[model samples]
Every structure is written in structure tokens, then in C-alpha cells.
Target chain A: MQTPASFEYERATSVEGAIASLQRLGSGARIIAGGHSLLPMMKLRLANPEHLIDINDLAELSYIREQGDELSIGALTRHVELEKSELLARHFPLFRDAENVIADPVVRNRGTIGGSLCQADAAEDLSAVCSAVKAKAVIRGAGGERVVGMEDFHIGPYVTAVGEGEMLTEVRIPLRPGGGSAHEKVERRAGDWAIAAASAAVWIEGGKIADVGVALGAVGPTTIHLSRAEELLRGKAPSEGLFAQAGEIASADCSPSADGRGPIDYKRHLASVLTTRALSRATARALHQEA
Target chain B: MHVSISVNGEQVSREIEPRQLLVHFIRETPDLTGTHWGCDTSNCGACVVQMDGQPVKSCTILAAMCEGHEIRTVESLEVDGQLDPIQMGFHEQHALQCGFCTPGMLMTARALLDENPNPTDLEIRTAISGGICRCTGYKNIVSAVRWAAEYEAAAKQEV
Candidate 1:
């Protein structure tokens, strides 16, 4: 008997049209892409938007391609596409890894990256994956579009930088040479949210770690950036010892509360172990040691 | 709101509340009750149906959102009194203990076989991972999908 509260629905013909609907409807209006996340929340009465602007027909906003020095992923790109994209697999294998475990294949077919990120659930994987790769979110509104870093994209749990009249249009990841990325997650069962997940991206130069990004999911109110761990890994040579030290930082930094998934201590432990494994795999790929 | 959707290749129009889910629409509008509504949440795939040839959880989708899209329910699996290979496989393999999860399983397996004519046991398991059988009849269900895969592959070869 779960159902959303009564609301007006409109199909947007174009991105501009969707934005116009949102602007006209004001704060109560929500842009629904894929509707996997939003509809579930609506059913539970956790979300009660007065108007829903369906953006599923905006096929022009569905793509994954390389533009200039970055990889541009259209916000409407379905999770199935992300999981199957050889382009994404070749450049950022972490996307494939995260997508593989995001949900069951059937659910993935209907879920979109934009909706996943905009939902801003701490247990969701893509937000942590995007944070680890230093991806920038492109938000479009009736006025114009603005790009925001992943760190700033999430305001809090279930809150995003996408404003009243705005929607996320794309995510841009800067393509750097000698870079590799990987994601690791531990969940209780199939299609379940992560108890604790870690995503790591490493760029090696001269046999040393030139830059690194490490983030954790389901371990905090928002995606944990792991600046402490990143700072610890920078300039260090790829080694098991260095990664183990970084894992310690991840374990210490994340703030996880106890729930059905696990206790706080267990989640912290998972954060550490998953971080080390992700870093190890990422560095191995960066050095071309593993595919 | 008035919503028109192609259910089983036939246009079914109705005046439903915008909040009405696609599963309820399918059952109440066209009287296609083969698609069960379970878990009301998306966790249980009992409400699964094919949208534009891909399996989606109908319980999580709004009827308003399905306007103009083609939705195939479990009832579509049988045409002219001939069951889909997936349904036949389910029958031969005894895939259902209670039959509550059968409709969703059939549609999910049908969509998987349509996309991948030959799926390994692991692939079949992965494809239906969204579904939960309280009876825990997954072993037979996986066998049913594999049986259907082989049946379709062999049928295509003969053609």
C-alpha cells in the first residue's frame, strides 16, 4: 500500500524545458531521472515534492564520452551503461567496480548517476567513487550551468548542491596520465547498501605517488574525503607499508554510527581494510601491473 | 491524471492518481494481476515487469512516469496458448514453491534471456539478484533460467 502523496507530473521535452518547469514550480518541484531513488523515497513519504518534472525523455543528456582532457558523463546516463562502458572501464575501472555492486542488474537498468548522486545517501557508492576521482558535477538551472567539486556537491545526508530550479547535468573527471582507480565495498547481502566502501584513485610519477584521492562511503554523514589519508600517501612510493599506514588514517578519520549493517567499530575496521585493498589495486593498475 | 501506456503491446489508458505505481496500474487498469505487488519497496522483485524490453521494478515506478512506454507484464509471456520458454522452463524445473515470486522471476528471466540468449549460471544468478524468494527456491529458479537459455539457443539454431 506504499504510495507517494498526490503531486502534479510533467514530462520535460528538453533540458531547458525541465529547468523551466522547476523554476516555475519553485522549491516544491523535483526533477526525476530514472526515478529509482526518488520514487522509493516518495513511497515511504520521506520525500514529498509538490511537482515532479520527468527528465527521462531528455535523451540528449545521456552519454559518456571524452571531451578535451576530461571524461564527461551525462547525468542521465543509466547505471547499466556505466557498468558496460568500455570507455569507462579503460579509463576509470572504479566506475565499473562500483556499478557492478551498486544494486542488482535489474535496478541498475533504471537508475541514473545524476539521481544517485543527488539523492546523496551516505551508503550509496557512486558519490564516494566520484569523490575519489576528483570528479566535478555540472549543475544546470534556468539561469545557467555551474560546476562544483564533489567535496562541495553534497551539503548533507539526502542533500545536494543542486538547487530549487537546478539539476545535475553531467560529471567531469579530469583525465590524468599515470592514473588508475579502484573501488571496494562490503555489503550484507545482494543489492544491499554498503556497510563501508572505499574508492581510491592514484597517479604515479617517477615511481612515486604524485597524487591520490581516497574516499569512504557509509562511514559518515556524507562521503568522507579522507584528506588525512591522501596527504599520507602523497609523495610516498607504492608499497604495502605505505598503504597500511594510509588505512590507519582512514580507520581513524571516518565517523560511522551503529545500525543494522554493523557496529561503529566494525564499520571503522571495514573502512580501513577496504581502503588498503582499493589503494593496493589502484596503485597496481597505475603501474600497469594488473588490469 | 490521465495516463496512457502500452501494456503487452496494447494501449491502456486510465485516469489514475499521479502517485499510483505502475504495478497497481497494470493490475487495476488492464486487470493483469499476474504482476504481483510485494515488498511495496523495491527490494522484492515481485513487482517486476519489462519496460521497453528491459526489466524494471514496477513498484518503484510511478504510472505517470510510464506514460508512452511499452510495458510487458507476466501475462504477455503466453501468446496463442504457447508459454514462453522461460515459463515452460519454470514448469519443468518446479521453480516455484508458493508461486508468489514466479511472475517476477519469469519476467526477469525472460528479459535476461532476450538480452543474453546464453547466460551462465553465474550470469543468471547475477541477473535475478534483485529478486528474493521467501521460499528460498533460487536453486530451481536458476536452473529454470538456464533451461530456458538452452531451449532458446537450440530453438534459434534450428531456425
Candidate 2:
């Protein structure tokens, strides 16, 4: 085993201390939350920092609460917690569904929502779900705090708006008046990264789709919002023909690559299939809410 | 960096470099040879251990991050010369052949069964999906967990 060169470890007592320590370490400092994503990159020599500021002890950043009309999930909340949270099962069941299919049990036990979002892996499940839910990522940097909408968070593959010394503190998802959602994905194996996944959340009022969000994963450099697909569904009757057209639009909108999992055409086909299925299920749930 | 962790029911502290992984700390610092390191990328659960009662891939976790946590390896599964149910199930059900993935499988099973005593076959399979077994083919491992669940059920009924 190759031992990395000497470096310093600072256990930050608070988020402010963590930021200060990161500044002290200059550009070479990196924040360690769950370490699921960062440490592996370190071992593969993809990422090596001079200082590791451990922020796992900041217990305040681990909660799922209903604040105002939105559900605020702290950045450090583990995947397993989301998998079993009754609040999530009620308000944002699509997130819980996505969490259930993330990696496997051991990874879910240690992997945090913020870590996955910060890792920004294109194939990751939660990133697409966040986009589908239109969640806002509350990031705290030295300059104070700012909320970046999930759509604007990811700029490219494995890239995000998180800057130097910035820590993602919370993810706030709105509690829709007629909240109903669904998530579906096609993976090579049970716990493997998705080949392509889709999430659908819609608000239905008086038998008409009021508002809708559609997000796709593993089909582009970053999780993409299928605006054409979403526009087709919004204010529509949520019928099968509309969903089929939406799926067609989604398949055309994405730019998936021909990777080891499947061909680009097959992935686009899957994009259509999974998108229609997720939207159908989400629509069914939305109808139930209207009832 | 000086890190202290309760490993295998013993509080072992060691001064190590910042890059020292938690798996290396357990395998070298404490000299607990039961924990194996197959794939260092955290893909293979060969270095799985109960970190503060949660099963985590030690290869991906920094030793310094586990300064105050309780870690349990395969060596800690035995109590008073009696094997833990997971180990016993492995032995009685012929769950090992080369014994390389046994410790990880056992710990993963321990973590799973501790939280869910009545996991279905698919649940058990998902619980140990992180682990890779090149020898036993996972049939017996699944049987082993099922046997352990039954054994625990019987014991509870007797009590």
C-alpha cells in the first residue's frame, strides 16, 4: 500500500471553524464529511490535499425537518436515514425510493446526501432526484450562505458550483400543495450506478396537472431537466399519449454516451421508457392526492 | 496524527500518518489479521467493519476520522471461546472455501442481522452485495444468514 505524504488533520468543532481551517490550509485544504466519495478519489490518486478538515462531528447538520412549507434535510443526513425517514416517505417519497436503490446497504450506511451531491457523479441517483424535486442546495461559504437551485448546482460531469472552502449545509425541498412523486431507474445490477434514471413530481389540481418537474440521470454530463417533457405534462390531463410524447421529447433532449453498460441509442430508449414509467407512476400518485 | 479507536473491544491508539486508512490501522496497528483488504477503492467490502455499530468500508474511511468511534472486526465476533452467530453459521453451513471474503461477509451479515433480524432472501443478498466472494458463490453465504436467523429465532423462543 502506498502511504500518502505527510498531511495535517483538523477536526472542526463548528462549520465556522471548518471554514477558518480550510482558509488556513489555503488551496490544499479539503473538507471531509462522510468520506465516501472524497476518500476513494484520494486513494485512486485522483485527489490529494495537504490538509483534511474533518466535519463529521458537526451534529447539527444531520436532520430531516419540515420547516415552513419545505422539507429541510441537513447535508450530513446519511442515505440510510433517508431510506427509513417517515417524513421523507410522506412528503418526498421519491427521494426515499431513490435512496433505497443507491449503492448497497454498507454504502448507504456511510454515504451522505451532501457527499453524493458534492461528489457530483453523473451516474449518482440523488442528484437527478434533487433536480426532479426542484430542491435548493443551501451552501455556506466564507462569504455567507446562498441557496443554489438544483438545476444550477451542477455545471458539468463531476463538477458543481461548490467553490473553495464552501460547505453544503442543507437541502430544502418544497412541500407542494398536491405533492405526489415517483422515481424509476434501470441499472446493470442491483446496486450499481444507473444506466439512466428518471424522477417525476407533479402537482395536480381539479383534474389538471398544475406544475410538474422531470429530471434525468446518467443521460448527460450533468443531471438534466427535461423541460420539453415537463412542459408537455404541465396543465395536461396526464394521459398516456401525453406521457408518450413527453418520453419522446426526453429521449431526444438527452445526450447519453455509448458506455460499457449499453449503447447510446439503447440508453435513449431507456430514457423514454423509464421516463414514461416514472411519470405514469407519479401521475397516479398525484391523482390519488387530488382524490 | 494520533488516533484512538476501540477495536475488537480494545481501545487501541496509534500515531500514524494522515493517509493511513482505517483498514490499515486495524490490520497493522492492532495486528488483527482477520480484516482483509482486497480492493482498496471501497468497491469490495473486504475491509468492512462495524464503525460505531454501522458497517462501513474501512478502506474509504480515514483512520483519523475514527478517533472516538468503536470498531468491530472479525476477530471481535467471538465471545468466551464461542463463535458469534455469523461465524458459527458460516462454519456450520459451509459458507467459506478460501476464507478470504469470510471476515467481510461475516461483519456485513452481523451489521445486517443486528438491525434487521428477519431480513428476506433478497434483503440478505442486498445486505452483502458490497462484498465479493470468488469462491463460495454466495449460495452458502445466503444459507448461512438464513440459518443464523433461524438459530436466533429458536434461541429466542427457548428463552
Candidate 3:
């Protein structure tokens, strides 16, 4: 029947109330946002939490705002919102790129950013997208709010820094000048997970790359952050050769295993090509040459 | 757990387990088998239903979480023997051969036309990307949605 194991469910009225419930219930308590990612896992019996804290009622948490030096996206924001957010498109088009390819519109309607990040599936798109944008995860708990980088936010596959009682409240993408980001993914079908996806962001200043972030999905145990490629791209002039070089670095850094998606060699090749494509597109956008 | 959800247009309360999926709840409560339960995973949109005006895969949603929300199933598409334009369009275009994916496709198309009244062929295809139709190769299904859009638009213009 593919039904989840019996558990208790309650709607959370506020973030504080949700935290309190988690505190009371301890580690066995989990929050249900859109249930697109979580419920499927639950039905498969991969996730058997004793309590599900329904956060759909927490309307105050759904928002996308540009405040101070960063763009703050609330955790409750859905995939459809990200796909349609003009503000996000203006700053980081990679979000729209990833959202369009995340899943079908029906699943996107109910899935939330918080839930996708918390699910932390290695093959998932958003984790790599967030990492390529250098976004910060805002985790709320009894100790108030703590912001952690994507590197630390994701501890491993299906594992995150969100502790027993902590809930991810928002993701903050730093507003960097001359920055453009793109996500390149090749899935087997319309809504399937990527065989290997690459997300790349480049910031150009004085015709040279000021900073860059590149990450890959479905190729490693966790979202593979190409720190070596990022370091290699900094302060370099944007060019096809440089991007290809960075792609080579990305191909070598990612640790992929063979499965239905492809052989290990094919995945590494896809990763390299996608990295180059993303970097080329990102560079074009940063230089304002995108059509 | 006791959950009260407005199904179609009626407020029906039912006692359901926390893990009970919404598809099962609807089928068992109102006896609306029109919403087919295919792929218990969210991959198949056969269980697509409107939750407060948006189409969502009911298989992945817990009925307990649907409390106080409005759910619209395919059973509500026909009113007093007058079929919804989407259903009629499907019939007219021969959109279904096996009929397993019709309900989900119809509901998904309903939501698409609601948000985007005049969806292009590409848009229609994108909207129903979650739905899998093993028959007609989706050419007829796409035409069916387009026909509904035209039908609804014409009806609006006449009004």
C-alpha cells in the first residue's frame, strides 16, 4: 500500500510552537512542509518519525525579500515561487534554471524549499543550487537563529546540520556584484533526478572573475562542492578555455559511483561537460552578453 | 486522528490515521474512485487532486495534513450531468485509450487552465509533465487541454 508507519501529526501555528513541539518530542519528531520529499520517503519506510510537525500553517514564514546585503528566501517558499520569482531571476537565474528542472509542476506546487534542503538527497538539484550561490541556511532553535554556510549545512547524504530541535527557517543568498549563476542538468526524463547536474555562479569585476561557486549533484555521496575549481577560477579572465579547465577540475574532484544513471565514467564525463556549460552560461550572463 | 476537510464542496469529517494518504481518504470517504491511485510514489500524477485550488499529488500528502483545506477530486468535474469542459474536451479529442491517466490529466489540466487560461501547446505539455498517459502518445491529450481552454474562453466571451 506504500503507507507510512503510524505517527502523530499536528499543525504548527508559529515557529516557536514548532520548536517547542520538537523540544518536547525530541529527535523522533520531524517537520512536514510540502511533504513531496518527506512523505514519499516515509511511505517507503525510509523515514519513520514518531511525530510529524505540520508547518503548512506557518504562513508568516513564506517570503522572498531583499534586505540589507542579501536576498532572504523563507523556508516555506515553494518551487513554483522560485521558478517565477523575477527578483531571484534578476540576482541569480540559477534558481529558476534549477526550479524548472526540479520536478513536475504538480509536485513543485506542494514542495517547499525548507523541506527540499532538509531532505538533502544527494541527487537533488536544490542542494547544489544553494551551494553554487553560496547561500546560508538559517536554522532556528531554542537558542534562537544560527546561520551556517551550505558547506556546513549539509553534513552528508540525507543528513544536515538541522539538529533534533532545530528547524531551517530561511536561506540567505549574498548579493554579490557582477554575479551570474546557471544550473545545467541532464535528467533521463521530464521529472527524474539528474544523471549528473552542475550548478555554477561567477562574479566578474574588471573583466576578471572576482569569485565563483560550482557544485554538482547525483555524482557523489553528498552535493559535491568544487572548491578546487572555484579557487582555480578566481581572479581569472572569463574565457571558454578557463571554463573547460575548471570543468576538468570539477570532473576530477567529484566522486561518482556507477548506477542506473550511468557508468562512473559517463557520470564524470557528464559532470565535466555540464560544468563547462554552466560556467560558460554564467560567464556570459555576468558579462551581460546573454541573449 | 480526526480530520475535517472540505471535499469537492461538502465539509466531511473523518477519523483517519496520521499516515493515511489523502487519495485513500477521498476514495474511502466519498467513494470517489475517479481519482486513481497509481504509483504510490509522487512520480505518477494519477492521484492528482486540487488542494485549495492547486493540483497536488494526493498520494504523497497525508490526509491528516489536509484538515481545514478544500480538496477537489475528479468526481466534482461533472455537475448535474454537465461535464467539465476538460472532461468533454477529452471525450471530443479521443484523448484517452486506456483511461487510467485521464482523471489526473483532467485535474492537472483544470489547474493549468485556472492559472493560465490560454496555455500554448508547450505550456500544456509542461503543465501535465507529471501525468503519464500510456495511450494516444499525449498528442490527443495536449489537444484536449487546448480544446478545453478554447471552450472555456468561448463560454466566457459568450457570457
Task: Tell me, by DockQ, which candidate is best.
Answer: 3
Over the stretch B17-99, how does candidate 1's per-residue lDDT look in tens digits? Answer: 88888999998964699999999878889999999999999998888998888999999999999999999999999889999
The C-alpha lDDT values of all candidates are 0.93, 0.87, 0.93
Per-residue lDDT over B4-109 for candidate 3, one digit per residue giving the tens place of the 0 to 100 score: 8899989878878888999999989747889999999898899999999999999999898888899999999999999999999999999999999988999999
**TM-score of candidate 2 chain B vs. the reference:** 0.96
lDDT of 2: 0.87
Q: In model 1, how many backbone clashes occur? A: 0
**iRMSD per model?**
0.8, 1.8, 0.6
The order by descending TM-score is: 3, 1, 2
Please report the candidate that would top lDDT against the real structure. 3
- The candidates' DockQ values read 0.89, 0.72, 0.94
lDDT-wise, the better of 2 and 3 is: 3
Q: Tell me each candidate's TM-score.
A: 0.98, 0.96, 0.99
Pick by lDDT: 1 or 3, better one = 3
Candidate 2 wrongly placed segments (more than 4 Å): A2-6, A289-291
lDDT of 2 at A38: 82
